[model samples]
Target: MPYCPPDCSCNLDGTVDCGGVDLKEFPRNLSESILHLSLQNNALEVIPMEELSRLQNLETFNLQNNRLTSKGLPDDAFCSLENLLYLYLANNKLTVAPKYLPKTLVSADVAANYLTKIYPLTFGQKPNLRSIYLHNNKLTDAGLPDHMFNGSDGVGILIMSSNFLKYVPKNLPKELFRLHLKDNKLEKIPKGAFDHLSKLRELYLHNNYITNDGIDNETFWKLSSLEYLDLSSNNLTQIPRGLPRNIVLLHLEKNAIKSIPGSWLTQIKNLEYLLLHNNKIKAKAIHPLAFKGLKKLHTFHLYNNMLERIPSGLPRRVKTLMLLHNQITEISRNDFAYSYFLIELNLSYNKLTSPKIHPEAFRKMRLLESLDFSGNNLNVVPSGLPKNLHVLRLKENEINSIPDGSLSGMTKLKELFLSNNKLKLNSIYPGAWKQLTNLQLLDLSGNQLSYVPTDLPESLEYIYLQNNQISVISENAFESTPNIKGIFLRDNRLTTSRVKEIAFEKLKFLQVLDMGAYSESATESKKDGGTSGDNLENDSEQATQNDK
Candidate 1:
């Protein structure tokens, strides 16, 4: 009995759920073993094809969103669904591309629509057509068709991103494996445009105004199973020289790459994740054996760029080396003397100074673990850093001092950022941070401190002596830490009688005691000394008993 079709729902196996039921047509009598026919979100301008040619086993035909145009579709209007296998006309107002379809169709989603020209055997010799979503629409490049992708079609996922293609769309189909031409107005890629694609593997030409004179130094040299290549932003001023040497993720961030010609990492020796940050790279235009054969290069992003130094033969199996900012002023004992697999080293800002570093500059980083050397023009703290350091960002530099065994071989130090810098309070020498035993977050904020610089590390949990010149706190100060938890002392020079009543009672995991404006003049001097307020009522009852 399944002949439903009118604002439909007849599902006893015959399947005919007319989606968004306001269907403005094409829903008569319906059931001829109609194998799924959902006229999605309807106002179907046309495509009745004689009420879908009496549905002879129509294998899934969903007219998505709909306002169907292209003069309401007539030529071969799906040649009567001859066992059609999935054809979703996405969005709709189709300006073409809805012809005969059925070469045993296996997925053809005419995405968005108003498709500006694409009529040459519309997906020729469809070898079981494998996924084709013509993204967005207004396709250009003369509306596409230079053999429209041959090799007898077995199209393996081809999403023509955005559109208005300026080049690179000629006879693509080498059974393409994920080729999304992003944005689009592709300013050129015509060098045998991937002749014989070799099962191309993920190639998204980012942004697109591709330069280097429209690319062709053997254009990716026949993509030998290329692996993930996103030419970021575009207008590249180089670095696109026969890429695919089994490329493993190579995204040229931003672009306009100034120089790095060591045969581009000896022709991508299995390169592993190399994103050239920002770009316009400099440091004498890079070539000191340009990263001597990457050897599985691990995360190397040259932040910002115009590098003035530190590009001295990098890749000692680099493990995250992002040169932040640039103009790096010296660290010279052979720069990073054959890196030794460095583990995170970001020379923040740059122009680093303390006698231009060389005291065995980081004596071959014994697996460094996070070091930023913030802002730079450093006053100290750079003998040979890497004691397996765990995050040591010398903030805004000009570091006034902290010398005696400066952070003595960091014993796995955990987060220590000498803030703003130009430090004081005897510039910290007494047992400096007693070898940080895993110190947890300590930023002597905005420096020039007057106190609180004692041998902190009892695995302290978050301490940023905000602003500085801290008035006083000597009741055994933080009584040699009790896992102090967040004590910022905001905008320092604290008052409440120079803070003493068991100054934060051994910080029982004290939570956020930021007294920035010193508790508003100690609660207005507690209404001008109410209970004979000596020592500002014992520093406001020891900061309300160490914040309960």
Candidate 2:
């Protein structure tokens, strides 16, 4: 009796659920005690194989995403499923690598497919073959043949990422442990290419064209149970002299790496996230004890490079320090004297200038929280920072003034960028932002201001003040913020009769009022739709008359 094909599903333990059923073929009534068969995502282009060779007690044969090819799989088609153990032909259109695989396969997903050749005894010595997903396929290196993973000694995870392999893939499989050759045209790494794997552990080889004399100083000296090593972007100019001290996250960013040898940070002293950003690093070729013995390092990116300072013996439990852009002109006060659990400090752009900061610079960080110092050439606002700051960017720079207590001990400042710079609404001072009071976003766009800056801080909610020359909108200018909601003041020199149309009627939860070049008198005061609260008529005057 053969009766379940209305988009199949015959169970009772002898499983046979036809998955994603648009079944173009193969589902023709078969229940000879099915053991487990899921024809996955089926527009089954042709896998009839004499009706699946009479399912000899199949044991999990999921034909994954099926437009099955290789001329419809014939010669000894899965050789009568000798009680197969998981063989999902992934993505499908397979070119070759499926010569009836079934030495009771223990996991074989012919990944993504179009497998440009793989012949030499394609899985012939399969003794319970363990995990082999031939990643994204057009695999090169002459279609892999020299002892094609010799007699699979229980191969363990070999995902050949994005192929065309220019090297390293010979006879691998001494029980390999995760070898994903990321983005391939792999340029030379043959010295015992992980000789006898020693149960390898996560080695990605990021982006590939691998250089620096194509790797040989004892390859990786037999991977001592490696732990995550990405070798980012590749063309490697240095730093690859047998790295394998049980590495714990070391992605060498972008490349051209100019010198790092402090005997390579004394061989990764259990490195904890050390990503050398962008590259060309040239601060007198490093080595002031080049990050002295990592000591459980915690995130240090060294962004952009050519560093003109700040690289002295880091790793006092570093907590995120991305020296953005570089040429760092001065930050001394024992420049981060032993990290002290620093928290997020990105010296934006760099050639910093506010008299090179030395008033006890950041005074032992105190668990600092987000301090960027955008662009550079700073003119002020650099007082001994770190009062548990919560984001303080200082955009562009040449800052002219904000004087009065320049942010009296931060008080957990909440995002303050001070846009473009050389500011001048009478150079700020009258309680300059009144001790921030947990200020909520205040950019002060571009610069050369004409007004708007008196004791602001009732926890203001977003105020950018676009471009500048602001021709007054005073009169209770937001009367100490009723939680103002976004007021940008686009382009500037405002008009609608120089602003007092109830100057935003005490904001009332205003929602975005941009007012670019006075938006045609705020669109004729919203076409004269008169209403109370001093008549500028709601929604922040239709958001400054639909801010165009």
Query: What is the lDDT of every predicted structure here?
Result: 0.78, 0.79
Error of 1 at 128 (Å): 23
lDDT of 2 by residue, 119-147 (tens): 65567578788888888988898877887
Candidate 2, poorest ten consecutive residues by summed lDDT:
529-538
Instruction: Give per-model TM-scores.
Output: 0.34, 0.37
Residue pairs with backbone overlap in model 1: none
Compared with the true structure, model 1 gives a TM-score of 0.34
In candidate 1, what residue range of length 10 has the lowest lDDT sum? 539-548
| Candidate achieving the largest TM-score | 2
RMSD of each: 16.7, 16.1
Total residue pair clashes for candidate 2: 0
